[model samples]
Target: MEYTKLTLGIALLVAFAWILFRNSKRSGVLHALIRIDTIVGMIAGLYLVITAVHSLFF
Candidate 1:
């Protein structure tokens, strides 16, 4: 598995989520979805970062 690509992709997802969050402040449901997406993306990004670091130094 390419942690680099996954991390980069998650970064893109977070960026996209940021854009969506800003643009969808007028809606309730969309905000909920965006929040879920952001949380998932952040968790995945954290896992990837930890795995990458472990692979590098362990």
Candidate 2:
């Protein structure tokens, strides 16, 4: 996939994961969901940054 596509995909995935994590915490389904959100968000941010850098530098 192209860098833009990858970046957007990552962002959407991260958002979805975060929403799930937040909702899961309400019912006390899994305490680890928050961690998942954090990790996914970090990965998404990394992807976005990398894409931006590549677009600018390359």
Q: After superposition, how far is residue 56 of candidate 1 from its true place, in Å?
A: 0.4
Residue by residue across 13-44, what tens digits does model 2's lDDT show? 67766776676677664655545765676677
| Model 1: per-residue Cα lDDT over 1-58, one tens digit each | 5567556756866775675576567576466566766567656666776666677678
Model 2 root mean square deviation, Cα atoms: 4.7
Alpha-carbon runs more than 4 Å astray in model 2: 28-58
Error of 2 at 38 (Å): 16
lDDT over C-alpha atoms for residue 49 of model 2: 62
User: CA lDDT, every prediction?
Assistant: 0.65, 0.66
Lowest-sum lDDT 10-residue window in model 1: 29-38
Pairs of colliding residues, candidate 2: none
Off by over 4 Å in 1: 1-34
For candidate 2, the lDDT comes to 0.66
TM-score attained by model 1: 0.49
Candidate 2 C-alpha error for residue 3, in Å:
0.6
